[model samples]
Target: MTSDKTELNDAELSRYSRQILLSDVDYDGQLTLTQSHAVIFGLGGLGSPAALYLASAGVGKLTLVDFDQVDDSNLQRQVIHREANIGQDKVASAKTNLQALNHHIEISTVATKLTEAELADLVAMADVVLDCTDNFESRFALNRQCRRHGVPLVSGAAIRWEGQLTTYDFRQAETPCYQCLYKEEQGQELTCSQNGVLAPVVGMVGSMQAIEAIKVLLTLPTLMGKLMIMDAHTMQFRTLNLPKDPDCKTCRD
Candidate 1:
């Protein structure tokens, strides 16, 4: 990790000059971002923007994991992929786009599905994890791994005209994890492929996920104990408290 007082290179100082001017993210906070390591799960709608912004913001390292490949349907909301990358693995495509955005940071790609042990290892090494996957299974697995590692997770989901964003900071003992809100056994999972989602809805949620990721990395106040809901149809937003469940199997002792 770079020291708070470490001098910034001319390009770095010029590139981040705007954010450095902000009182909240001055030199120290920006330095914190540069020292952070983020692991992003899923490279589709939510992960696309989350990964891009984190890289652009100068996160020191990013490991992108996704087993799927780009398809024509993804281009609408998956801004990181282009027509030329339609058949490429999502992580590979995302890596290309992110690398083009910022060449100073480190970017890694996991094009294959990760086994339980592999996921655990990655989560253990990450300073923060972003759960942008659409399925409940992956979310549950990632949540459990994050809890075990005591790492914070920025989770986002979008389907139809609705979107949801939240953070689970396992480092904070009382904060509720993803399992507290959605039990693993619950059925009737929804997906954009079947439910149909507005393009901008995903973009909105993903953008929020990126913002939450940065906040988590910087030790800033986050939506760790709350859920932010957005309705693209009515153009309305709401937030509600998310209390920790003492019996949560994933987070409880």
Candidate 2:
């Protein structure tokens, strides 16, 4: 039977039939995803998998923002960039790969470091924002913008054997934001270049980030106020409640 809300052509129906079979994502939910736009910051380890899955799942538009080039070391975990893409802009490489995955999707690339104003403008244009950057400054800036624009943000981090994923539904008055759990100056940055991350660990976290983004786009229940932590050594996963900080300067308003 065809859906009254979404008119899916034969191609679209065949492409997404498996997901549509699930009770959580029927025809209407699939249409919601196909009509949504997501802006992803940082096209590295976390953003790589997130962007791939979101595009594969048929998100209509994707904006890839990153200023770095694909390095030899990135191939260890950044699956979206192949060896041939070394020295190319990460956003460019990711755009090429994502478009290949889903030809019907629209992909935009921002190959420069985004200033606060530029980032805010992009975040405001998106239905959902994914924080895949590897630094506190970018995360803080994105969090502020998401709060300001009331856009949902799916945040993920992977370092060494530890990884974490969380979602902030800013549209919900009581949801905790990224700043509520992390302080900007609490510590020096620990990038994969320094601390080193397990390859699959980032994939796991990034894949989950995509899941949260899809749920937010479809208006389904997501990890809005919870954090999922993973320890790859023991393969243990833990969920912790994230409470909104009443004194958080970013979201306390």
Candidate 1 local lDDT, 79-190, one digit each (tens): 9999999999998889988889998788888888889999999899899999999899899999999999899999999999999999999889889999899998888799
- For all predicted structures, in order, the TM-scores are 0.96, 0.96
Give me the candidate number with maximum TM-score.
Answer: 1
Candidate 1: stretches off by over 4 Å: 1-6
Candidate 2 lDDT over residue span 1-253, tens digit each: 1112356678888999999998899998888887789999999999999999999998888989999999999999999999999999999999988888898778989988778888888888999999999989889999899999999999999999999999999889989988899987688878888889999999999999999999998888898889989999999999999998888877755
Q: Which residue pairs collide in model 1, if any?
A: none
Q: What C-alpha lDDT do the candidate models reach, one value each?
A: 0.89, 0.89
* Backbone clash count, each prediction separately: 0, 0
Model 1 poorest 10 in a row by lDDT: 1-10
